[model samples]
Target: MTDDVQAVHQPSDLRTVIMTGASSGIGAKAAATLAEGGAHVVVVGRNTARTKEVASRIGGTAHVADFDRLDEVRDLAQRLLDENPRIDVLANNAGGLVSHRSETTDGFERTLQSNHLAPFLLTRLLLPRIVESAGRVVSTSSTANLFGRVRLDDLNWRKRPWAGGWLAYGTSKLLTNMFISQLAARSPIQAYAFHPGFVSTSFGSDSASMRVLNTLTGGSYGISADAGAVPLATLSGPTTVGVPSGTYFDQLKPYGRQAPQAKDRILAEVVWETSSRLVSIPSDL
Candidate 1:
């Protein structure tokens, strides 16, 4: 984070917030909270029926997009920009943990692409609009970051046999914070990243490896889905609430702790430059 980037606290107007992964868990709960407060919510999720149901419940806009496909992400960005003249908040919440190491059709690691690259590209594409609206971008990260480390050279783990599935998931979360750190340094948009703790949701039920890991670790014993949502909801609340830009939160605490590297300027630059290259955006452009 840079000193040039300052927090612009605005009055709490009827904010138009866009929350991804709104079909379930924390995203869905955040959408409900914002909408109940008279703000217009745009609910995004991979599932068609559930997303529509959630949108219907809050009278919000629902859009289906699979982050595994970059094409869908691009289309989503286009639709949001075209339909909504102003976007007050963007929640980069849709992500997953793959049980096995794999790459998307885009040739990027599944967990890394879904959790980090997709949101990076989305924020870059919508940055101008976000600046115009003086909006905030709240990203959902994880407390599993304690077990995470970033490998700039082997970001996708294509060169190593030691890369496990959980490693990829953890690295993605760490990378998200690094991305947010630099993003705040270079831009004036109010942005925040948070760890929602271990929420009790069927987040990785599809994977046998993940299921076994969850059982052994009692991953389902954490707080409820709604409890994990408070941090995000608080950060996304009216600017009058007073949260510093580029800060990482542990649950609802504004100045919460993060892995040291997540806040490293040198590492943040490397991650930002590497990400821009991966997305084909020149750093100096």
Candidate 2:
């Protein structure tokens, strides 16, 4: 362990959890569950009012950040480091499905940047503290990963024509799994990625097609947000609960089926290296 980890040691019962995207949907619900279970939760979201509301309701702290911008993500990480001594869990759950192919101010594809690269930067920035605390990293991946195909050379989808952005969204989820796998391999901290089921939440609200599909399903095609958050809460808790590191959960089941590409170690390393450059972080981190 590093000096940073040793300086902020606390009892196991008083775990400090940092959950991104906690303003609504499964993230908010999971944050509440963790708080109810006695963890000190730090709720991070894009919207100020909603983030503050969730934090106040759960007796947690709120920090607002837009994932589209890497600088904001860095600031969020710095603030987290300054405010907390030890971080027991870092939930990389803030992401969305964009309606069209667009680039963020950071010059990366919107979906890829928001979903994968932003969280990647945050995790790398906070790695030392988390490693020393023996913390876990939990991410919200998806069944959409099955539809994903990652072209390591063009993660931003610049060369391919946008097919209504579903492919981009799917690829981002696949990247989530690869990130967890690589982090587990390289670090001492436990890492997990899970599919929360097809959840009926405000997710994909920006996409008209997704909205139409959700309306047509009438909430029948998926589970509720609260229901979808169970695995997330479970994985992020203090206890390891017998699940090995780097396991991807299909809902609640460990070692769930994943896209063959998601399991390719070489490809995962490539993603790590590529993402490190994209976010201007050290690849070894």
Candidate 3:
């Protein structure tokens, strides 16, 4: 495992898992599987009714969080801290693609903020709990990461004209990969990010064009939501899956060919630094 020049944290049994985007799609399916496997699953969704319904079905705690709102994410984190003293896995699975670029009230690009910033904040805020339990952080990433182009000068996409959602979404996933890699390198906590393939879920619902694209291409080729969920669940804990920490996966197999930026230590540091500033946290933490 030359790719894994860095050592990994000690593995432990997984008992409780907190998963976002559990209202539907891969998140929802993973929730069911984890619960059945005897892990206490925490379900976070954007919609209230759907979240509760899924929680009820899985017998897991439910929290509503619109990733576009940083405050909501903070609140969710605090609530989880109060209830769950120790979490085994923090699966950052909540994210989407919008046809056009938008900004959150926090004044950041919606896609990046939702997909990357919110999860980074939650993970940082919950670092103590994760360390106490020696838990792993598994994020839902994508193969689009190979083509990611993030502008360190303009992460908000304010100066860069809206070039459509594909690039923005890819950049977000790339950042996720970098975030996981940096965290693995700097800390003893275990972390992994994965690509779930072209899952047949309402992934890009916010965009009309995405919906049309899904309708056209998804029907014949898209994998079922259940199929996509398997990778996250496999990586959740007790993995015979064999992918090392700080590594990205194409579905189940460890992929050595990563975007050059994803493996750049300097870029990873930059992403982490910028994320710390944006999340209103001290970098020293």
On lDDT, the candidate that comes out on top is 2
The model with the greater TM-score, 1 or 2, is 2
* Highest TM-score model number: 2
Task: Residues 205-253, candidate 1: write the lDDT tens digits.
Answer: 7778667768887786668988988887777777454756888888877
* Residue-level lDDT tens digits of model 3 in 23-42: 89999999999999888888
- Against the true structure, candidate 1 reaches a TM-score of 0.89
Q: Which candidate, 1 or 3, has the higher lDDT?
A: 3
Clashing pairs in 2: none
True-vs-predicted CA distance for residue 121, candidate 1, Å: 0.4
Model 3 CA deviation exceeding 4 Å by range: 1-14
Query: Each model's number of backbone clashes?
Result: 0, 0, 0
Off by over 4 Å in 2: 1-13
Reference-based lDDT, residue 72, model 3: 81
Given candidate 2, what's the lDDT at residue 204?
A: 85
Task: TM-score each candidate.
Answer: 0.89, 0.94, 0.91
Per-candidate Cα lDDT values, in order, are 0.80, 0.88, 0.83
Regarding TM-score, does 1 or 3 come out ahead? 3
In candidate 3, position 279 carries an lDDT of 91
